[model samples]
Target: MARLDESARGVYLIAVTPFTETGALDLDGCDRMADFYLEAGATGLTLLGVMGEAPKLTTDESATIVNRVLKRVDGRVPIVVGVSSPGFAQMQALTGRVMDDGAAGVMIAPPGSLRTDDQIAGYYEQAAEMIGDVPFVLQDFPLTTGVQMSVPVIARIIKDIPTCVCLKHEDWPGLAKITALRKEGATARRVSILCGNGGVFLPEEMERGADGAMTGFAYPEMMTGVVENHAKGDMERARDLFDAYLPLARFEQQPGLGLAIRKYVLYRRGVLANPTLRKPGAALDPLSRAEVDRLMARLEKRLKELN
Candidate 1:
């Protein structure tokens, strides 16, 4: 198994699941996307995320996608798969299969039913046991999971679960959480903290002690540049590059419309051949596409000025 640890730091792009115009899984596109992300400076790839249309995939389809991504990735970089299921059995099975398929780790978000801190902590304890030593990422994105883990609660989970290695930190206004976790004596062990609000909060998050980012913005090179610049102590350059991409990043962060915009940008950049989304997904309308086109045009101009 590919093990993800605190030493892991950089852009881990949450990949999009592609489909044919007829709604069939685009396995070819998966291979292409894996290669594209790596070449674009992504240190890792996260699959089966919410933006990946995970729930729409059947068990067999999920396995096939994981297998295909691992095969294409071919051990170049770590792969993390989301295994946040309602049942432990399903989570266990998916985690096992993906780990067996060469995944580095699994990401788990608390189920919506979890209310109190005890319920959240207990669920992770049970999940850690079920997964049996597979390193996992605690996805603390409240907007999607509806489970808000306070700082103390997160520290408690880290203290108790040795296998909880990294956090996909997407809590809005989450800089304080990063600060709390990175603060001295917050926890016995320190784990990697990667922000995931579509890279909108990345500059401030990095400034607040986040390791890096793990969001699926269409242009991952933007994230790579920001993280690298920050690590080099070039705060001015990092902020400049981040500002250059901020408009599109903000535009792409729109909830219901974001995925469509991202897929279209990927398609326009030739990373994907088609922008077809699976059923029940939002597709880009003419006006939306035009808006994305304008954003891309302005992004090009701004990037040129920065360069």
Candidate 2:
């Protein structure tokens, strides 16, 4: 597969790590999930993301999942694996392994320890050096990392790191950041911007200059639909599609329960064998599951009406 670069665009779905009811890795379920994402119109795949439950996986397990998905995808689209770690050695090691295993690139999120703008910019500079020539996506998710990256700091990183090719823009109220980055000579060069936060802010992000989304939602078609319609200059159609999924999207954005909700919805959609999160994770209660069911039913109705 070609390396991910500034030209990358469209929905790069952040995939979930499927598990069996017994909590073992579900390789078959991984295949099924890959097929589902591609069929839903994803242009790329980002695995081992935060939503993929990355920290829970041992090194071997992470490699297993990445290889499994890479073989299944068969180079159909670029595969970006998350390699964020507290240390550069681990990040560089994983980057080498996955890049050797046919991954197009890797993603690195700022650790919460970063406080100053210089620290943020310096970290990416060193990371780029440590990872050698491997292209990387700079994950700017202040909500989870608690490390806010202002537009100037982001531009400095882009200016200093040649291999930093994309930004996973997940900062809340971040539309202005996108606008600032796209302004004349804001950075040394252009970098692709893909919005995250499960794509809730994708329409506005795109309007502000994002290329597309790099997030997970059980209904990825809604994301693809929005991007496609927006690219065609059909803002009203894009919004109508977004509105139909907004209820469930908002429901799934719940902090501790988001992944559980996503897994349950995928299982209900017949994409997963089970919705079992690893230990130290949460699961939906019966009432929450029923509520999700109702939302799914309503989404189905709304989609039908739109069609």
Candidate 3:
């Protein structure tokens, strides 16, 4: 098992699930993507995330994708599988299977139905019991999960659950949350904090004491480079590199349209064979495609200037 812990730090690319033009799972493309991420300086890889089109995959297909990716990666970096199911039964089953198949750990987001602090804390308590010693990342993106976890609430979870090792911190304007968590005596113990808003706030998050990123942006090299420079205390170079890709990253992170933009960029880069989403997923319009192309052009120019 990859078993992520507090000491873990650096870029963990939130992987996209590749598919054929007709919408079937692209197992071979999954292999290519794994290789591309590792070569681009990813310290780890997380799959079946929201950006991976996870909810769209059936159970069998999900297992197949995980198995394929793990095989291709072959333990070069930790592979964290997103096992956020509505039911603990399903979550437990998936976690067990993936761990058996060599995943390093799993990620869980609080159910959207959770509201009050107690409800949220209680839910994770049950989740911790169900998963039983399998390390997990607590995903804290209130925008998507609809369940906001206050700093105290998160501290409580960390205090109560020993296996909760990292956080996928995607709360917008979340720099303060990072600051709060890193404060002395906040959490019972230290846990790795990785922000995930498409790398939009990565520089600030890094400054606020985040470990690194676990977001899906087409140019993961940007995330890797920013984190590397930040670690080396080269703030100027980090900001410059982040700013160069900010335009494309902002364009690629348009909520409902973001995945289409990311997949297209990956396909255009030869990492994905075809930028096809599964059924019920949207495709980019010609106007959107044109917009992405223009952004990509600007990104190239800006990156050259930075260099």
Positional deviation of residue 256's Cα in model 1 after best superposition, in angstroms: 0.7
Q: lDDT scores for all predictions?
A: 0.91, 0.95, 0.92
Give lDDT for model 3: 0.92
Per-residue lDDT tens digits of candidate 3, residues 234-271? 98999999999999998888879899999999998999
Query: Residues 195-274, candidate 2, lDDT per residue (tens digit)?
Result: 99998988898899999999999999989999999989999999999999999999999999999999999999999999
Backbone clash count, each prediction separately: 0, 0, 2
TM-score of each: 0.98, 0.99, 0.98
Global Cα lDDT for candidate 2: 0.95
Model 2 TM-score, all chains together: 0.99
By lDDT, the best candidate is 2
Q: Ten residues in a row with the worst lDDT in model 2? A: 88-97
Model 3 clash count equals 2
| Model 2 stretches astray by more than 4 angstroms | none
